[model samples]
Target: MRGETRTVWPAARRVAGGLALLGAATVGYGVYERDAYTLTRREVPILAPGAAPLRLLHLSDLHVTPGQTRKFDWLGELGRLVPDLVAMTGDVLSHQDSSAPLRRALAPLYAFPGVFIPGNNDYYVPKPRSPHHYFKRHPGGPHKGPALDWDGFAKDLVADSGWRDMTHVHDVLTIGGRRLDVRGVDDARSRRDRVALVAGPPEPGADVVLGLSHTPEPRVLDAFTADGVQLTLSGHTHGGQIRLPFVGALVTNCGLDPSRARGLSRWSAAGPDGAQRMSWLHVSAGLGTSPYAPIRLGCRPEATLLTLVPAR
Candidate 1:
């Protein structure tokens, strides 16, 4: 029995040591990949036939704080793209004063016409918690911490800078020589979304119709689809923030499926008649993570530039 015990102990120690090294390596890589930002570009066929192409830039889940100089610089550089319209789904501040950093991150985007709504993170700060909490069906404790300065930021953007506030409303605008019927709701995760207020078919004479939200909960998305939104944009998944090789995202942190956690995909839901309706859905992996749990694995931070061309 003593001889057997000695052999088993050595083997167990070797396995434990190996696992510890692997865990350390993973943490190292996640930290390194956090700042390894990239831009994802895609072409969507949502424009009218023979219509001139329009550039649309989709940015989301900024979650920016001070000292992230690299993020500030990269965002400033996107001005060269000169997108005709910019759609920012929010999560802009991370509990900082946000006066300078918010301006530093978003002021350049205001060079063009844009529309945005606030995320839960914009209303209050996220408290530090274990990463494991994220995987559970229902995370406990207070999700929000200190209050953020959302009103000041809104005034600066909407009142002063001419950007539309798309929170819980639908409106029509002419952009790039085409009529656009745009609708959006607040962050759906916190039950702030009021899709009923903006519910209805696409407006007449609109060249395109779309919707936006911070969290892409299926019910909100389904409502948008039923309302005849041809395209829908959302963020807050962060592409699971820690993807695996073959298995991919273990959880989306929301009701969204793991497969469609990030990037472009078709969203379909059943209508009243039980027939399936579909629309183009683009979920930004997002530009940053919550400051408290700032690590990424196979998924890198990203912004998407979607070139909208004529429908096939």
Candidate 2:
């Protein structure tokens, strides 16, 4: 009886160990394949929806490395959703020299009307540092600003893709009876932006006005809101890149509170009666990272789908 009991015990222990190993592998796969698996949903309000609902696709931060055709294919798949208009809020490429690949990746997006703004990464190359070195303080925090030539890059992009260049400019377009006034600025950290390029007290006839920026700095958002822009889109913070389960994102690069760092939030202005008039602010968690900094822990990159619901 003792020998038979011992034999059973060994078999049970072996099965338990095998199960544990399998569990570990499963968890590892879940984390590694997170990018391909995760999709986040966020709905934003469009004040005056025209005859039919308009779907807008917001794509941001494709920090592409050279030879990443797979990433480009994923971007092309975005068209499958049939967005009426698309907005790109910067960091389209990791290196200024690699703009060609970013252009190629965005070629599929040209099927619809698209507007673009550049992030610091596109114009200001981060100094080379160790793989996990982003945690360490920059000691001086980059006294010298972004070195890229904005005019040249903007020109090349326009010529190459035929997309509207929203760098320090404003333009209006009509989409199904709704007029979209787009006001955009260059990266704020570098002071390359000038609000005057797109300044105005909102045109009386437009349904909505969009304010664009790579970083959602308070001053920048204020400028647009003061101008009566109804909505603002930004994507400099990678949704804190690594988010913890219930606690959410660890850090947002800007001054925005962590809760408002990545999704739909409300920005309001007070009227004569002291009632708050609000607008929708949508920030994408972004799609990729700089080639040098390649791993994203808890946050999966995103392409936001903002469906315009008429004011109820």
Candidate 3:
């Protein structure tokens, strides 16, 4: 009996130690992944000329709720990056009344010039879910309410942040005689894209042209390319949000190939006269999960840092 008791004690001690180590590892990984695990990527021969490289920061699909302290802290810390300009694509709030919290969450970005567009999630979605999925998951999946006040939210966002309301519009950024034209459309999920806004290229002498949309639909992509836009930045699919190591993305919402689901992709353009050109396309993975679906598995949220260099 004494001998058996000694052997059992040693095994139990080993099992306890193993459990403790596993718990520590899990906690450590959560912390590491929670902080901005930024992946740096680039495209050389970026089509700009004779100017110092301009740094453009891109963030999207925030879905910020009422009390996301971590997200606010992260945005505030972004002031350390000192980017020349910052742009957000859409879905700023998880719900319409969340505008107050969204404003507070975005206060840090006020230090720099910024632009924003609205996603389908913003305009008609309820507290926990967007209207985009209303019919798909009927019979009561997660959401338990009606739509929201989109007009009031839109007015407040424009008034508070002074953001460029690029819903079917364009704006230009100038530095040392070179120009970067930016054009955007509303959410493709809501089918509000006005392709005409992206049909005309800025007049000659524009150094770079960028297109913005909430989703990466191919029709809009082709239109932007047709307009002589050199780049397009978008965020919607969450980069599959829970990518597997070997299998890659489980799903991609748009025509974007699974390989180009979250990061930079290259697109070729045909000139109005029929000559071919090339450009870069970057898609941010996004910051927060939909309120109805909280918890990201593999893909951590990201803000992209795009350094646009002159063609060599």
Candidate 4:
């Protein structure tokens, strides 16, 4: 009996040590993936025949801190692209001091015309919560935290940077010498999106129409589809934040399905006649994670450069 006990104890220790090593390695790798900033290039078919392609840069979920030099550097590098338009589907801040870093990171891109809408994180600071609650009871509307200075940021964003703060607004602007219709609302996950106010078909004869939201809730997408929006850009899922090999995204953290957590997918609203009105939807995996839960697995942080082409 004594000899058998000794053997079991030795084997148990070895197994426990192996598990500890694996856990440490997993955490280290997750951190590495979080920092792996990447850019995804895709083509958006949403223009008239013979119309020139408009390069659009979609940015989201910045969640910037006071001095994240690495992220800011990457953002600065993107200025070289000189895209025709930029869309900032928000969550642009995670810390009280994030505004400065956020401004520095995006200053380069501001040179181009852009549109923006706020995300939940933009208004409230991210707070740590029980892991299970991340899926079961993730926050919405507002939670306990210090407020971010979004007003100051928004004011300067329009007056100084020339970017349009498109929250809850519908209007037309000229881009690429063509009329582009844009409509966007406040963060939908927080129940702030008042889509009905601006709900309608694209401005008559507008060359292109686009919608923006921080969260890709199904109802919002349906509204955009109903309105004939050519393409809609959004973020807030963080590409499920943690992905797996074949399983892909485990959770969307929003009403969106796991499969469409990131990248382009067709969206539509059901027509009364059992028809589907399809519209283009591009949900950026986004460039940063919530400051409280700063980790990534198979999912890398990202932005997307969408080149609008003529639909066949």
Candidate 5:
């Protein structure tokens, strides 16, 4: 009996030690993943026939905090890509004091045309919460935090940058010789999106109609698709921030399906003729995490370069 007990005790200790090591390794990996900035490039064929290809840089969910020099340096270098257009879906700042650094980081990209919309984090500051909250749908209610001065942030960003504020408004721009009818909404997570303000068919003679929003809510995507918007871009899901192998994103945090939380997918809506119309959807995994939950797993912080080629 004594010999058996000693063997069992050793086996138990080994099992416990192994679990402890695994937990430590996981936490370490999460920390490493936070700073693992990656650039993802994808070729999307969505242009009209005979139109020249356009290079688009999709940036989102920066959640910038002061003193993240590495991230700022990385962002400052993105202009070297020389994208024809830049689309920033929000959460640019996590703290009110982060605006200066955020602007500095984005300064290089000002040379190109860009457009932006605000996310929940942009309007409200982030408060520390359990990381587990990300894995589940946010309980519906008002988020608690000090409000941010989004207007000032927008003003600063647009001062030298050609980026347009597309929240609750529609505008047309000529880029790469194509007339882009761009429409956007403010963050829907906070119920700030006034979709009706910009809801309608694309302006006649526009080459392409695109929709932008911070959260990839199904209702917004539906409205955009119904109005002939051929493509939509969004962020806010963070690709579940911590994904699992094989299973992928654990939660989208919005109406979007978990499978479509990141990367490009197809959204279909019934057209005026009752025919099914499909729109291309691109949801960026995004570039930064909330300062409180400063970790990532399986999903790396990313900025995407989308080459909009002529459809075959």
Candidate 6:
């Protein structure tokens, strides 16, 4: 009996030690994932014939807080990519005091032409909630946190940086010698999007027609697809922030599927003549997590550099 008991005690000790090691590793990994900044590059063949390739940098969901030097450094480094255009899909702030740091970080990219649309977080700050709640469907209710100064945010990002504000409006621009017809709406998650304002087919003779929004809400995508927009870009889901390996995002928080929470996919809708039209969609995984829940797992915070090549 003594011999048997001694053997069992040793085995139990080993098991306890292993469990403690695993727990420590998990916590360390969570910390690492939160600060891991990754850059993703994708080649999208969506340009018209005879058009030159356009290099576009897509940025979103910075969730910038004061004194986050790593994130600020990463933003400044992005300028080295020298993209033809920059598209920012909001959630650019988290704390009221973050504006100055955010602007300084983005100063390098101001040299390039860019467009921006506001997200829900841009208009209102985020409040703390249970991390587990992120995996469930978002409950619609009154927003938390104090109201943000969206006008000032826009002035710094749009006016000071010389970037275009595409909120509920359409514009035509000549980018890299190709004509682009771009239209965008405010965030649909906050019910701020007025899709009717810019709902129409692409302008004639436009080399490329693109749509931009903060959330990849289906209704807005449907409207853009119906209007013959060839491509749409957005961010807001954060690629679930804590995805699983192979399983991917747990919840998109919007109409988009979990599989497409972060990357490119095709969006289709029925036209007036009962014909189906398809458009390319790109949803950025984004750069930062909500300040309250700062840890990430399999999903690394990211910004995407997309090369737009001519389609066959």
Q: Which candidate has the top score in lDDT?
A: 5
- Could you tell me which 10 consecutive residues in candidate 1 have the lowest summed lDDT? 95-104
Expressed as tens digits, the lDDT of each residue in 56-145 for candidate 1 is: 899988888888888899988898889989998988888657657767677687789998888878989888888788797546678888
Model 5 regions more than 4 Å off = none
Clashing pairs in 1: none
Q: What residue runs in model 2 are displaced by over 4 Å at the alpha carbon?
A: 1-41, 49-51, 130-140, 143-150, 269-276
RMSD per model, one decimal: 2.1, 5.9, 5.7, 1.8, 1.4, 2.2
**TM-score of every prediction relative to native:** 0.93, 0.80, 0.79, 0.95, 0.96, 0.93
Clashes of each: 0, 0, 0, 0, 0, 0
Model 4 TM-score on a 0 to 1 scale: 0.95
Any idea how many clashes model 2 has? 0
> Between prediction 3 and prediction 5, which has the larger lDDT?
5
Alpha carbon lDDT of residue 98, candidate 4?
Answer: 79
Query: Number of clashing pairs, model 1?
Result: 0
Judged by lDDT relative to the true structure, which candidate is superior, 1 or 6?
6
TM-score of 6: 0.93
Instruction: Please report the TM-score between candidate 3 and the true structure.
Output: 0.79
Report the C-alpha lDDT of model 2 over 173-195, residue by residue, as the tens digit: 77766788888998874566687
In model 4, what lDDT does residue 177 have? Answer: 81
Evaluated against the true structure, the overall lDDT of model 2 is: 0.73
Candidate 4: global Cα-lDDT? Answer: 0.87
- Angstrom error at residue 141, model 4: 11
Which runs in model 3 stand beyond 4 Å of their true positions? Answer: 1-47, 126-145, 175-178
Worst 10 residues of 2 by lDDT: 136-145
Give one digit per residue, the lDDT tens place, for model 5 in 1-312: 999999999999999999999999998999899889999999888888888778889999999989999899999889999998999999888987988888888899999999999998897788877756766676554455888899998988888686899999898888866789999999987789888898888888897788999999888888889889988999999988889898999888888899998999999988777888889999999989888878889999999999888888
lDDT of all the models against the reference? 0.86, 0.73, 0.73, 0.87, 0.89, 0.88
Of models 2 and 4, which has the larger lDDT? 4
lDDT winner between candidates 3 and 6: 6
What is the overall TM-score of model 2 with all chains considered together? 0.80
